[model samples]
Target: MAHEAHSHEHGGGEMNWKLIVVSAVFLVIGLFLDNVETFRFINPYLVLLIYIVAFMPVGLPVMREAWEQIEHERDFFSEFMLMSVAAIGAFFLGEYPEAVAVMLLYCVGEGLQDRAVDRARDSIKRLIAFRPDFARLADGREERPEAVTIGSIIEVRPGERVPLDGRLLDAPAAFNTAALTGESVPRMIETGHEVMAGMIATDSIVRLEVVREASESAISRILKMVEEAAERKSSTEAFIHRFAHVYTPVVIALAVLVVVVPWLASLFSAADYAFSMWLQRALVFLVISCPCALVISVPLGYFGGIGVASRKGILFKGSNGLDAVTMLDTVVFDKTGTLTTGAFRVEQTVGLSPEDLAFVAAVEAKSSHPIARAVVEFMQGKPLATVDSACIVNVPGYGMTCGEWAIGTLRLMKKQGIVYDEALNEVAETIVAVAHDGRFVGYILLADTPKAGIFTLPQRLKAQGIKLMQVLSGDKQALIDKLIAGFHGHGFVKGYGDLLPEDKVSHLEALKKEGKRVAFVGDGINDAPVLALSDVGFAMGNMGADMAVETADVIIQTDEPAKVVEAIAIGRRTRRIVLQNIVFAIGVKVLVMVLGVLGVATLWEAVFADSGVALLAVMNSIRPLHRPRFEEK
Candidate 1:
């Protein structure tokens, strides 16, 4: 036992929980042996020595910490000192079993906390592993992604991730975009499509013409966001840290008063007094009020929340953003490129055969116009008939013309002397009027379409306690009405259109004046001002754009507005669990401290109040890492 104490003293033992288990087992055996006439020692001191030996392994680490605090930092009132005083006082009081139990429980609790922290940080470590470190050049030279120059070509082989943000050279391929978009379905791409750095080429070796340097890649920028995420603490986290600084010292001072005031009062009274009794009460008070849970558990919960969010492809700038999300009463959305896919898509096809549509798609495939691109995208699976590249002439103002089949606006139909019905002129939608030789084939109506996954988003946010949902757009009021009507107009959204960027800012300011905590969600590229102006700005659907990352409080790596619902759900759960830890931990500690001072609670209860509350708080802090209510994944 003497040798064990010497080793623990010099070895600088930390909170070694396995040693705690061993000591606990030794303590149980010592107590059992004390009851047996044959096994028990005759000398009471030798019997007490067994308990003392059991206490040494668990007690020395905390004693070492208290001594180091006194020696190096000159601070004697830390939590370690409080626990040390309590354990040593219990030994002096001849509460040998409790003296062993307190340190054992405290070490186990602390060890559990360290394990939770390591578990929470696992997601970040996964993020670091997720990044593709090396790029392969077309010539088979391997280089670090950051060293690769812009416009240089890199090869992404089968089962390898793209190493930089670049355009596909010539081969059409399928890529697993789950790292960027959070969608598991493979994204099929054509020759000129821009592929992001982390996308894994599913089947074949595909090459990319590097458009952005590796440092500027989406994954690199996201990594930067995540690594620095915990620096800005939540208001709750900040308050606890500040509270601990004053709270621990006050606890120690109160503990001293607990012993001294009673002894002073006894000096003036006729009542018999013992120094040991008052000192024991003070020691229990110190043990019960160490503030371990209050100091560490809040940040543990928030850090886990941040790590979990990052793993889901949602990057919160800090835990403060996570806290802010719970308070949002209003979520305002920008219509263009946010709620709706910004580009034109085929909304309707009138009088056009599937063959005519296919023919038209083949011709429009040659043009880079938004409407033409939309047509080709709509016909993704349908076979496109071949177009004659030799005689294909793109008239600047109108549209494309192959030999016999001409697909363009009505003006092109008039120019080609192809007579179309007068009703074609009355069509409100932007249309492609197809002409076969001199006969008019039917036209296709193109419109900007709403995204697929956002129908449940508004109600979900409302259920999250967000009161108002609205859209702000620069499009015409009529167009905005049309879009809102598609969402079942009377449902929840209030539309404001014909607004400039300044108008959007003023609208947000007006909502703020109404005492609303607003979160504005927009394509982070163009809404920099509005993004920065709101209570919590959510930047949507971009991975590689620097402006998107810099402008918003939260970055949704995928382009789904439904992710906003997931973000709110995650944020609320994290903050809720953190508050639970705070209330439960502090409440138990306060109750136990009072009981300890009144002599109603023993060292056993005080130990439970200190470390047991901490263990429960730590367990609660990890709840945020589980899937939120709405999350299936």
Candidate 2:
């Protein structure tokens, strides 16, 4: 399902190299008959016949395409029609070599550009490589993922990919999300959490209850998006299409004027203007005015940019997504998944000895509460004291206890008459009070810890010309303040917490009214509406809700905030290269056309210049593909 029924095959078919080779042989013979002394006795019409044969092999396809466009699409000013006209005009002027060379070299250039585009597309289609061929059910029978109905229980052994999006059952297990997220670290998904398809189980065998069907999974949607991205053209592409429609017809009119105006002037004034000379100049004008370079290179540049982003695990929904990235002025972030891990972790310890932590960890290991799990996970790789589960006592609302130890809230301390610091009530984070031998020990402060590399991401976005960075979360105001204080040294980021989904939308609407181009980054599952409201919505994961997959403008598969800056950098690079091609192509064409009118440029000279400029523009358009790996600033 990931590889779909899309075919990249151009309607023109593959490069007609056999046809080109045959045509080249005939053209060479024609040249020998027209100019060689040994063939002076041959009839001139036979020499013309040889050249027409040379032209048909390469020329007929273009002529057929032009006729079809005119008959079917009513598009008379197409590049196909322009090249066909130029070829026939050269034949009318008795310049047989120039006539055949124009179409021949054009086919060559077109073939090269098509190959380059195919390679760029192949880079993005690498996503299909992550797909698994079969799903193993709990009964040891294998089936296609599409046949596995929702709510079915499936078991995936270690080193296997999850075939469908499902909820983890039984126990927590680690999964390697490198294929989806581009991050190499193994991620542990707790019991009851949604495990998306394409994640490889890294350690122990895990069982899952399918929550979504194979056709509705994240990988399927992403593959569909990648296939449609090229069709959803950017603003520049739309503009170029409109420009060509008007520009080509006008250029054709000017080429006619290049002949008729001179002839009319010779009849009125004392000027000696030959009709044949002016007609040849008009042929040069048509050859130079072909819009091949501009038309092909513009899309080539954007495709190259898309290819670069895909390699780094970033997916832009369309080329317009690339354009939107360049205009982002203000960036809004969802705190939990965007800046922090959104999971509780022990931040610090107050006066707690290693022995006390060990005792607390050993006692906490017996519980299924989130806070208890946080303590157990944090104590990993460290020492822990032994405690009997039979002797441990669980207080319904306070905390847990074991032999000679009481761990809970201030209420537990007061109930047991254990005295502790009353000032600790002022702490904003979750506080775990510890007691050893019925005496007050110390406490542990826990909160959602920041992700590994988010500290540097704010500074990098600012350096990339992002005007302001802000955070809006449903987390408590005090906790939000603490998180902001943690980032205070790194950069200036505005924080606003305790906002509901609707409140976030209202705040962004106000920002939009004030003319701020906003981009909001979130986990996408919980904040799909706010993401949809933003100018550019950046969703964090491939495992998010179906609404998230549909609403987001860009998907950061790696779940990294830093990828946004990289997307912007790529947009800027693509825009610069596209502009260069537009100016370069038109500038060269205009200059050559003027020289042709003044009789300073020849037909073959104009032909070579046009082909050379196209080749160079295409070379420049593909520069994004070979760009070095992005450096994290």
Candidate 3:
């Protein structure tokens, strides 16, 4: 059954491709016949027969789509209507080939648009499938399977999906959250730490008392937002809708005037103008005024931009959100998952001699504690041999140890009968004390390291005149300061630590008050509030929290910080194409309308002005698909 559904989707894509090719062929032939009189020697009826044959595939889809919209009672007349009217008018004038050509070109443009929409929606749908259906709970004696329900308080074993939004009730465990944050490193979640659904447990089994029900959980809300956002139209699209309303009526009126005014002028002035010539010019006017280019290409350009973004691992909900990203002048990032690697690492090791340090590292290496991993990684590659110790213990929020070497905070070491050296404890970095057989060995300092491309990110944002780079996070002030010290001193970079989800939203609101066009980038379930409130929200699409991805204006599929730059570039490019299409479509139609009134334009010229302009606009709108510019690491 799944294979059948997949095949159906594949067939849909194939059909669109076939339609585009067929329509392009018809358009080419139609243009050729218009330019070369030799092709006109063929009986017009024979030409008309070929034209109608070419029109079927293109016309069928347009008519189907238009019928769907009409069924839903949509007031806006679709591009299909413009194509249909132009074709019917051509047939009325016995210009059969032109009628078919207009529908064919219009269908090619619609096919491209449909494909782009499908690509963007498919990218987002993949994220929706990540929600787990079952939860495992820790009974007093053994693990038991629990039926998943919204708001059900359940225990999560190590390496299991968090079943609901809840607070941790057990000891700290390492969390493999790459699926939510796009950063593959595991994060440590301690007691009182809030974890959302979709994050996988990596180390020890930690119980979470569910706070939010499954239905009202962060993931559900985000999914709803994404689904709704797709329907929201942007300013340019709304303008196009209004333009079509006024433009369509005016053109219909002009077509009427074209027939009446020319015949009346010929009668009053006693000029030698033929009635057939005037009527032909009127038919040509109808063709030129179809507005297919503006109707088809503007939306197609935005749709193509969204598709291109999806290809690079960004999921834009719709064209409006995609368009808004280009206008943003400032970007605010969540400190933990957005700017930094969100993984704690050992920064320095101190205390015992090099060989003794290796012993402590070897023992600590087996543990999954963030501090333990940091310490072990610090001593990596050094020649160290140590027997496996008997008693391994972990002290949450402090450190861990094996046998006699006690690795923990200074307070923990003091409780273990080890004295903290005044000089050693005064270091600026995070300190974890080490004790050997009740004697002081030294301390290991751990910190959240910046991602590989982080330093360059601020510089790139600066170059784009994105003057604001702020971090809103729930991390401690000391940690936030230490993590961003290198970049935080800049006037444009600000760090706000100890922020709640609501705090981040409030901060973003303040930025808006200051007149900054803000874009919030985050990954956690907690980030959803700010994601929704921001002018534009960017989620680390790949490995980002489901709720955050759903709430975001754009999803960075690769979770690369630099892709934000690429998204902004796409928005700008799409806007440029939209403007060019509008200008070119309207300019040609206006010029041809003037020529028709002067009897200098023929029925063929009007058909080209209508369908050819639409084809040119559609082709131009898709040009950005070939010019994607991603940020370099």
Candidate 4:
């Protein structure tokens, strides 16, 4: 059967394509008429008539957007209002070409701003495309997908997106999570693995009993967050709103005064000079008064910054959060899953020789388990000989093995008539015991190890003026103590173990109270609340839970701890560029407006004042795209 394409009522890509084509047509017509000598002989009035017709395709939409804001009782200060009023006034002064030039240039600027917004929104829309549309049931039935409403259950087969929030009902499966995490790798998931929607199944088909419907799933919530963030205005946008609030009505009042006062003054002064000269000056003021730079480039800057961060695997909840990250002075990290690998590994192995150990290791490696992978990673360089064995078994939270040579939990060894040896057990690190033909052999120990370069990360952060480094985890005190001991006297390295999700939130709140900028780093379903509550959150992408990545402000795509430092540097550099753009734009506009009011500038100067500043601000706003600073540890 041919599958139907997923449809939405939102009219995706249609309006954008129309805007692009219309903008292109207007630009071409304006350029052709301005350069053609044949058109120069045409009355300037007739030429403007043609130019206004050309401008309508782009100008009508701008007018419509302004009308919508007015209808919704939103503030009446918009760039469209400024452009429309200025062009009308210019025409009244018999400057038809100047009127057309003002509207045409303004149209081009609006088109560029719209294109940038569309690009940022398209990035988020691509994220939404990962939603699954079909499910294959366990009863040999394929089900037609329904709308992703709240509380709906859906089934997912191997190589399909998990359609809803669910728990595994059958054996373990492997999942390729590159779509959500930005890590191009697959992870193994066993029974009771909290599976979220939008993850692709890689190996083995396992049944997932849906708990939350597709709409209420994590992916749906994340999509909503991203959309809200894109729409949320930055501080620069707020300033523009306030400026327009006063600037628009004030300009209209000034234009009225210029018309009435000049006629009033005509009785005392030369009448023709007062009428023509003051009216011309009023039109020039109107052209210069338009806040085109603020209206066009401020939102573009915010949108572009957000888009750049998303490309680097950072998910800013809103422009507010994106701006906040750049201002942060200190970044706090949750230790267990953020800085560490978050999985157990064989730190050391003892007792048995290399040959004997390989046989026991092969028996334990037979099962699909996290501990099994840890053992394999530990024995990476050691020679291993395969042993022919049947009756391979797995003990949950314990161990596994083949035949009489059993490698499993301490309790399993005791049950199998094996004697306890404390000295050898301490040396092995993780609890792993072996039994050969119903006799006790030896065991191996494992622990969750720190990620590469984690020990040296604090030094780099301190050099960047990050004053505090704290490790908060739910792991037991013994493990936390081990981690603290590993980093003793390394620039305020401390650990608080056995913290619940709520406890972590409380700790972040306290840090905020102390006027400290805190950034939480975590992975796992339990860390979602803490991630959302912190000033900024960074999640470890590889092996991280879906909730962590979605909640985090920044996601480290690679396993290296050094990326944390690099991300901070990127944040600072982007912020510097934003400030530079704002200062340059506002300063130049003020100086030029002063000169124009004193009769030192003309209508052409006004055009350059409005459009040139806007263009420069836009160019500066996108500087982060080329100069992204990555720190080397």
lDDT of 4 by residue, 494-577 (tens): 778778888888988898899998877788788888888887887775557777877887666554566667666655655566
Give the clash count for model 1: 0
Q: Cα lDDT of model 2 overall?
A: 0.82
lDDT of 1 by residue, 1-633 (tens): 111222343332354555776788889977877777887557778768888888888788778877777787676766677788888888888888888888878777776676776788887777666578799999999999889999898998888988898999967999988777667889898898789878889999888999998777877777788777878889998898778768878988898998888888889998777788778888888888887787768888888888888767788889999999989988999887789877798889989988888888988888888899999999999899987788788988888888887888899988989988888675545778888878987889887778886667766776788788999998777677877777663657888888998999999999999999999988846688899999998887463245755888898877777778888888888888898998998898888888888889988888877887887887888877776454421
**Candidate 3's C-alpha lDDT?**
0.69
In model 1, what lDDT does residue 170 have? 65
When 2 and 4 are scored with lDDT, the better candidate is: 2
Model 4 lDDT at residue 394: 68
**456-567 per-residue lDDT for model 3 (tens digits):** 7678886555777877778777666765677744777778887888888788888899998899899999999888988889998655787887788887856787878777
Query: Residue-wise lDDT of candidate 2 within 236-312, one digit each (tens)?
Result: 97898778788989998999999899889989999998988998898889888988788888887888888888778
lDDT of 4: 0.66
From the highest lDDT down, the ranking of the candidates is 2, 1, 3, 4
TM-score of each: 0.86, 0.88, 0.70, 0.73
| RMSD in order of candidates | 5.0, 4.1, 8.3, 7.1
Residue pairs in collision within model 1: none
Instruction: Identify the leading candidate in terms of TM-score.
Output: 2
Tell me the TM-score of model 4.
0.73
Residue 520 of model 3 has an lDDT of 89
